[model samples]
Target: MSDTELRNDGRLEDEHQLDADDRLRPEFVDAVLDAVENGDTEEAHRLVEPLHPADIADLFELTPDERRAPLAAAVADLLDGDVFAEMNDYVREQLIDALDARQVADIASELDTDDAVAIIEDMDAEDQREVLRAMEPDDRAAIEEALSYPEESAGRLMQRELIAVPEHWTIGDTIDYLRGHEELTTDFWEVFVVDPAHKPVGTCALSWILRTPRSISMADVMQREQTLIPVDMDQEEVALRFQKYALISAAVVDGSGRLVGMITVDDVVHIIQEEAGEDALLLSGAGEGDINEPVVDSYKARVRWLIANLFTALLASFIISMFETTIERMVALATLMPIVAGVGGNAGTQTLAVTVRALATNQLTQSNTARAIGREIRVALLNGVTVAVVIGVGVSIVFGNPMLGGVIAAAMMTNILVAGLAGVLVPVTLDRFNADPAVASSVFVTMTTDSIGFLAFLGLATASGLVG
Candidate 1:
C-alpha cells in the first residue's frame, strides 16, 4: 500500500510518525491539499482533527486566504468557538464575515464575555448589532454593558459570567447552587459573596468552599479583603494589580462597588501581551503595528512620525548650516563630525528606552523623577570622559591636527553629556503633560542630540580657529 494509504489505514511505521513541528511539514500540508483537491473531506478532517484550537488557528493563518474558506468548509464543525476565539483578528474577521449573524451569535454565546466582545467588536457596527439581536436577552444585555465601557478598560476585559452568591448562603448552599445552576459560568476560581444590594463584600475560593463545613455561612467562610477592579480602571493598571497581588481572578465592580464581572488570569494574559506590544510599538513611533492594518491606516499612523522626524532632521541641518564656513575650511571636520553625533545619539537612545520602560512600569514617578534624572546625568558625565580620551588620542594621530582632534573630542564629551540629560528629561516632561512618552520621546531626543552635536562640534572648531 502507498504511504498515504497506509497512514490513513492506521498502519504507518514509527519512522513516519510526525513530531511536534512536523505537523506543518511540507509533505503533510501537501497531503491535506491533495485530499482537498480530491474531495476527500474525511481525510482532510482526520488530518486536522488532532490539532489544538491554537494550532488550528495557526493552520488557518498559515494557509493562503484563498484556501482558508475551502479548508474551513471541509473541516466544518471542527471550527468551534475555541478555534474561532483563538484565531488572528484578520482571520477571525474574515471567517465572521462569511458566517451569518445568527451563526456568529451562536458561537459567541458559547464564549466568555471578554472573548465574545473581542470577536463582536471587530465586526462592523451593523453586524455587531445584528449578532447581539440574535443572542439571548441576558447575554445581549451583559455584552452591551461591557461594550459601554471604553475600549481597553477593565470593563471590556472582564467576563460577565461569574459565580456570585448572597452572603447569607451557607457553604453547602453555595455548593448546591453551583452544582444546580447549569447556566452559571463553567470556569471560575472564586465565588463572590455579595450583600442583598449586590455589593461585593468578600470572596471565597472554590477550595475553601469545598473544604468548609456545610453549615458555615459564606460571609464567615469568605475572606473579607479582596481586590476589586473598578470598571473604569485602565486595563494596564488592572494587569499591574494582578501581577502585584499574584491574582488568579479578581472581581470587577461598578461605581457603586457592585460586582459587575470578573477578570481572570486567562483574560489578563491577552491584556498583558497587548500592553507590552503597544509599549514597544509606541517607543519606536509605530502605532498599533498590526500586520493586517490597511495600507492607508498604516501610512496615516506612520507618516506623522516621519514628518516630525523630518522637522527634527531639519533642525540638525540648520545647526550644521551655521558651521558651513568651518566645514569649507577643513574637510576633515566633516569626516569626524558624524562620529560625535552618532555615538551621542546611540547613548541617548539607550537611556530613552530605559527611562520609558521605567515610566510605563511605574518605577519612575514624580517621587523619584529628580533623583533618576540626576543619576543619569552623573552616569553620562563619566561615559563622556571615557569616550573623549579614547577618541581624542585616536583622531589626533590620524589627522595630525591636534587642535582639530581636541576640538572634536571636546564636542563629543559635551554632546554626549547633554544627550543623556535630554533623553530622560524629554520623556518625563511629555509624560507630565499627559502625553505618551514613548510615542514622542524618540523624536524629541533625536532632535536634541543632533542639534547639540552639530552646535558643539562646529562651534568649538570655529572658536578655536582650527578651521579658519
Candidate 2:
C-alpha cells in the first residue's frame, strides 16, 4: 500500500494541499460551502480538514459574510488558534463577535501571547473584559498585562513565551532543565541567560548550547553582546532594530531592565508589512485601504482627501485665472500650458515617492539631506533639460511659432527644476517638523509643481509678447 493516506473522497493527502496562489480553488470552496448549506457538517469537516491552518483561514475569508458564521459552525473543530491567527482582522472580528466569551477565551488560550493579544485587542471594551474574565488566570494575566501596554508598542507585540535561564548554570544543567521543563515554550532559536536579578545578560543559540562541553558555564558560552528591545518602543522602531541587527529574536526589557518577553522575527515580518502598506496608503491619503474595511470607514478616510484635493486644485485654477487674458489671446498657450504642468506634476510625484521611502527606511538623514537634495537637483536639471527639448520642439512644430516654443521650453525647464526641489523639500520639511511626511507630502508637492508650472509658463509667454 502507498504510505500516503487516501481520503474518503478518493484523493491522496498530498493532493489536498494548498496551491501556489495561496488561495483555495473555486470548486473546492464551493464544495465545502455546499456541504455546509446541506447541513452535512461531517463532510464539510472532511473537505477542509486536510488544508493548512492558513488555507483554512483563507477559506473563512472567501466565504460570504452571512454564511461565515454557518461555515464556522460546520467546521467548528477546525477554528483553532492557528486558523484564528491567520484569519483576516475583519473576518476574525466577525467570527469573534459571534462567539461567547468562553469560546473566545478558549481560542485565545491556544495561541501564543502575541497572537492571543491580537485577537483580544480588537474586541469591544466590555467584550474584552468579559473574554479576559473567562480566560484561565495565568492566560488572563498575560493578556491583561499585554493590554496595559500601548497599542503598536513592543510590549504589545512581544510574546511572554521564551526560554530563560540563569547565567551561572552549566551546559549540562541547562540541557537537563530544558528536557525536564514541561511548561517551557516549544518555539525558540536561542536561550536567554539572565542575571540573579532576572535582567538578561546574554543569549546562547541552541546550536552553541548543544555543541559546547557539558561543563561549560552559560555565562562563558553565551554571547554577551545582545540587542535588548525596550517594551515601550514603537513597533516600527522595533522592526528597524531587528532589521538592523538581523536578529532572529530579541529580548524585550521593561523599565527596570528585566527580561519580560521576546519579539521574534516572525512577528517583525508582520509589523514590517503593516508599516510599509500603511505609509503607502497614507501617501495617497487612502486610509487602511483594506478591502475588509467598512464602507463608511473607507468613505470617511477617502472623502477628506478628495475635499482637500478640491481646495488644492482650486489654488491651481486661481493661478490659471490670473493669466486668463494671455490664454484667450493665444489658444495655443492654453493647449501647451497643461503639458508643462502635467509633466512637472508627474516628475514631482516620482521624487516625492523616493524621498518618502528613503525617509521611512532611514536612508535619508540630516547628515545626508544636503547631499541628497543636491543629487536630486542635479537629476532634476538633467530631466528638465531633456523634457524641455522634447516639449519645446513638439510645441514649435505644432503651433508653427518658434517664440512660443522657446517660451514653453523655458517654462518646462523652470517648472521641472522647481518640482524636483519642492518634492524633496516638502517631505524633508514635514519630517523635520515631526509630521508624517507620507500623509501630506503629495498635496503640497502637487500644489508647488502646478502653481510654479503655470506661473513660469504664462509669465514667460506674456513677457515675450507671444500671448499678447
Candidate 3:
C-alpha cells in the first residue's frame, strides 16, 4: 500500500499500488504490465510485492489475456497457491493451462486438500494425472480422495488438515502432543476430541483448552454438543448449516459416522457468496454469468433461455390472435394490453423472488406452504385492487367510456390474481418434484402473466360488449 517509485515515467509513477479500498490501482496494474512488457522483471516484482495474495490474483484478472502469461511469468515467484485460490475460476484455468505438470504439482502441494482439489479438478484428465504423479504420495492421496466425491459436496469442500485428539488425553498431554508434532494442522479454531474409534465425541475450542488447567482431562473441557456435516451433503446445504448454527468450524463425517475432514467458516463464506450469486443468475435464466466466461460459452448459456422465452411469447401471441376482431373494434384495447401484462409480470416476479429465497433458506417448508401461499394471495389482492382503481379511473376519463374502463379494470384485477397464484405455485411445484425452482420458475411465471393478462382483457371486453 505504500508508495515506491519503481519506474520513472508519469504513467508508471507509483504513488500507491493500492487504493484505500485495498483494490489494486488502475495505474498500478498498468505499471506492472508496462514493466513486464518492457522486459523489466525487477521493476514488475517491486511494483507487485506490496499486494496481498487476493490482490495479486486480481492483478492477473485485470491483465489482458495475451499479457496474463507474461505478467504471470514476471511475477512467477509471487504466484503461490494462495493467489491461485483467490483467483476467479476461469482466469485461474487460463493460467493453469500454461503451467507444466510438475510446476502445477509444486503449487498444489503447498495448499490444503480442498484448495488443491479446486485447482486440479478442472484440469484436463491426462494433465491431471501427470500433476498427481508429480505430487508427493500424501498430498496426492488426499486430493484423489477428495476428487472421488461429488463436486460441491462437503467431501470435496472440506480440508483433510485438522486437529483431532483422544478424549482421554489430559490437557497437559494434548498440549505436549501438539508441540511435539512437526506436521500438525497449521490453522484451526477447535481441537476435535474423538472416541477410540476416531468418531468425534466433542469439540474443544482453543480458548477453553488454553484457559483451563493443563492437568485437567480434555473430556472435562470439551463441549459435547457439536454440529456434524455429512460428507455427501451439498455445499449449499453446508453453508446453510454453518449460517444457522453460527459455527466457526464443523467436523465433516462419513456415513459410518467417522470424522473425515473439517469445514471452516472461511470456506463456508465463499460457498454462501457463490450460491447466492448463482441463484440470482439462474432466476434470470443466465448460466454462471461469469465475466471471464468465453464468448461461445456465454452465447450457449444465454441463447437457450432466450429461445425458451421466445416460445413462451408465442403462446401469448396465439392468445392475442383469438381476440383480433375485438381489438380492432376498440383500437384502444391494443394500447392497454401491454400495461396489464407488464404490471402483472412485475408483480409475479416480486412474488417469485420472495418464494425462491424462502425455499432456498429453508424458511418455507411443507408445514408452512399453505400459510405462505395465503399470505401472497392477500398481498396480491391488495395490489390488484389498487392498480385496478387507478387504471379504471384513468381510462374512464381519457376515453369517456365507463363500460370500457370497467372491462379493463376487471381484466387487470383478474390477471394480477392469476399472476400471483402462478408465481407461488410454479416454483413451489417445481420444488416439490425435486427440481431447482430458481432455474425454471421465471419462464412459466412470465408466460402465465402474459397469456392470462391478454386473455382476460380481450375476453372481458368481448363479454362486456364494450367493443360492440
Candidate 4:
C-alpha cells in the first residue's frame, strides 16, 4: 500500500469510520451507499473524498457487486490509478469495463510502467489497443514493451522509472543530476551504477551516496555483489530471490544483460501474496478463489475438480464391491470399515498438505526427497501402531471376538501405512513430471486412502477367516 496521505479532515475524525485493522466500518460503508442511493452526490463526495486511494478501492470491494458501478460513478473523480492498483482484479475489471478507453488511458498514464501494464494486460486486445492509442507516447512505449514480455515475469513486473548513473560519476555529480532533473522517479531506494552500454555494474544505496564525500566516485561507494533478475524469470522465483536476499530493489536485465527496468520490494509484495494465495487455492482446485469473482467463474473452476473426485469415488466403490461376500458374512465388518477409510483419508490429507507446502517453498528438493519420504514413513508407522493398539483392544471388548479385533487392527495399520505413502509420493511424483503437484495430488491421495482402507480391511478379514 502507498503511504497514502491521510485526508484526516474533522468529518472522518468524528465519524471514526475506520476500524483498528484500517478497514472501513460497515456503518460507514452503509452511510456512503445510503448517500449514493439517495442521489446526494455532494454528501457522497464529502464522505468519500477524504479516503486514501486504497481505502477507496476497499469501499468498492465491500459494496455489493451490483452497487459497485454506481459507487464508481458517484466517486468518479476520486478513482485514480492508485485506487485501481489496489482493487481486487475482478472488481477492477468490473469497473474498468464501465469506463471509456480515454478515461482508462488517463488513469494508466498516472501510474508507473508496471502498474499501467497490470491494468491494461487483462483487457481484450481491441480495448488494449484503443487504450494504448490514447496514452502519451513515452508512457505508451514503456507499457507496450512491458506487455511484450511473458505474463507474471520479471520483465512485466518491473517499472521503467528508476535512478541510474555512470560508474565514473562522483557523489556531487550524481546529486546534481538528481537535483537538476525534474522528471526523475521520486520513489527509489538506490541508484544503479551502469557501464557505457547501460548494463548494471553495481548498486549504490541512497544512504551511502548521501554519506559519502563529494570526491567519492560511485564505483568506490557501490556494492558490486547485487541480485540481477532475468526478464523471463517467473514471478514466484523473483519473490523467492527478494526474500532470500532481503532485497529492497533489484535490476531486471534483458537476455544480453542490459538493464531493462527496476523491480522494487513494493511490486514483489503483491506477487508474494498472490503466489502464496494462488498455490493454496490451486491445492483445493478452487481457481483464483477471489470473493469478488463471479458466480459462474467460481462454478467453472470448482466443478471440474468435483467431477474428477466423483470418478475417483466410483473406483473406491468398485473395490468395496469386490468384498461383497465377506461383508455379507460379517455385518460388523461393514460398520467398522468407514472408520478405517475416514481415519486413513485424514492421515493422507495431513501428509499431502505438508508435502505440497514444502514443495512450494522449495524446502523439499531432490537431495532431500529420500529423507522426506523416510521421515513421513516413520511418522506413519508411529501413528499406525498407536491407533492400531487402541482399536484392537476396543474392538475385542466391544464385539467379544478377539479374531475380529485382530483382523481390523491389522487392516487399520496397513491402510494408514498406505495412506502415508500415497500422501507423500503422489505430490512428489507429480512434481517430478513438472505437473503442478497441488492441483491434482489431493484427489489422487484421497482416492488411494479410501480404496486401500476398504481393500485392506476386507482382504485381511477374509484371509484371517473372520469372514466367509
Clashes of each: 0, 0, 0, 0
Residue range 186-215, candidate 3, lDDT tens digits: 799999999999999999998998899988
In order, candidate lDDTs are: 0.86, 0.91, 0.91, 0.90
Q: Estimate the TM-score of every prediction.
A: 0.91, 0.95, 0.96, 0.94
Model 4 segments beyond 4 Å from truth?
1-23
Error of 1 at 79 (Å): 1.7
Expressed as tens digits, the lDDT of each residue in 239-308 for candidate 4 is 8899989999999999999999999999999998988888789889998899989999999999999999
1 versus 4: better lDDT goes to:
4
lDDT winner between candidates 1 and 2: 2
lDDT of 2 by residue, 1-468 (tens): 111234456353434344545336666677788889999998788878877798899998888888999999989988999999998999999999999999999999999999999999988999999999999999999999999999999999999999999999999999999999899999999999999999999999999999999999999999999999999999988998889989999999999999999999999999999999999999899989988777899999999988988898999999999999998888888878888999999999999999999998888999999999999999999999999999889888987888988999999999999999999999999999999999999989888888899999999999988864
What are the per-residue Cα lDDT tens digits for candidate 1 across 57-125?
A: 888877777888888889978888899889888888888899998999899888888988889987888
Question: Per-residue lDDT for 31 in model 3?
Answer: 75
Given candidate 3, what's the lDDT at residue 202?
99
Model 4 Cα displacement at 248 (Å)?
A: 1.4
